[model samples]
Target: MALFKRLAERQRPVLEFTLDGEPASGLLGDTLLTAVLTSGAHLRGSDFSAEPRAGFCLMGACQDCWVRLGDGRRVRACATALEAGQHVLREPGRRP
Candidate 1:
C-alpha cells in the first residue's frame, strides 16, 4: 500500500517526468520525494552500501532523499518540488 494517496475524487493536474529513464507522473505541488514514494519508486541508493533508500525524514533534515536532475545537479528530493518534464536519476552513480 502507498503511504500517500490522493483524496479528491477529481484528479489534480499531473506533472510528467522521467524516473531513471522510465516515464512517470506525479501530481502538481507534490515534492519530488512524495511523487517518487507515492509511485512506489525508490528515491535513491546509499552511497556507502548501495542499499535503496526512499527517505528517513519527509522534511529536509535526514539527507536521505537526494536525487540527480537531468542536468546532473543533485538536490534533496523532499525539498524540491516536482516540475513538468523534469527528469530524475535515483541511483548515485548514474548521471542525468
Candidate 2:
C-alpha cells in the first residue's frame, strides 16, 4: 500500500539523470530526494552504522538527505530540484 496518492490523474514531464553511473528518471518538478526515492535509490548511508538513510525532516532541518554530485559537491536532496542529466553519487557512511 502507498502512503500517498495524487488527487487527479496528471502526468508531469520526465527528466533523465544518472545515479551512481546508472540511468534514472523522475518527474521534472520533483526534488532530488523524491526522484531518488521514487526510483528506489538510497539517498545515502548513516555515518555511525553505515545504514542506508533517506529523507528525515524533508524540510532541510535534518541533514539525513544530503547527497553528493559527481564533482564532489554536496546538496540537501529534499531541498534541491531534480535536473535533467544531473549526476548524483551515493557515498556510504559520509557525514553531512
Candidate 3:
C-alpha cells in the first residue's frame, strides 16, 4: 500500500547516544527520552514526575520532555537530537 510504503520510507536509521555518563545507544529518529527509557536506564527529565525520568509524548507539544543540556540550558528532550556525547540533566531544583 502507498501509506505503508510512505511510512517505511520515512523511517530513518538508528543513531546512538550516551545517556548521562552511561552508554545508551538507540535510534536517532526517536526522541532522546524514548531512546534512554527504552534502554532501561535512569533519566532526569520531564518524562516522569518521579526521579529517574522517562519520555511521555514523542512530539514536542508536551512540556514534560524538558532537560538541561551540557551548557546548562533547559530544553525539551522530545524536540532535541540525541547527540553522541550530550549530557542532559533533569530540572535540578524543586518543582514549582
lDDT of 3 by residue, 1-96 (tens): 010112242366666655565565556566566555666544452333355445456687857667777688887777776776676565533442
Segments in model 2 whose C-alpha atoms lie over 4 Å from true places:
1-10, 94-96
After superposition on all C-alphas, the RMSD of every candidate to the true structure, in Å, is 3.8, 3.5, 7.3
Q: Per-residue CA lDDT of candidate 1, range 22-79, in tens?
A: 8888898889998887776467878777766778988999888889999999999999
Candidate 3 weakest ten by summed lDDT: 1-10
- Residue 18's lDDT within candidate 2 is 95
User: How much RMSD separates candidate 1 from the native structure?
Assistant: 3.8
lDDT of 1 at 21: 88
**Candidate 1: residue 54 lDDT (0-100):** 75
Better of 1 and 3 by lDDT: 1
Clashes per prediction? Answer: 0, 0, 1
Candidates' C-alpha lDDT: 0.82, 0.80, 0.57
Off by over 4 Å in 3: 1-14, 41-53, 92-96
> What does candidate 3 score on TM?
0.58
Q: What is the TM-score of each candidate against the true structure?
A: 0.83, 0.84, 0.58
lDDT per residue (tens digit) for residues 14-91 in model 2: 899998898887787888887788676467888777787777889989888888988789999999999999998876
Model 2 lDDT-worst window of ten: 1-10
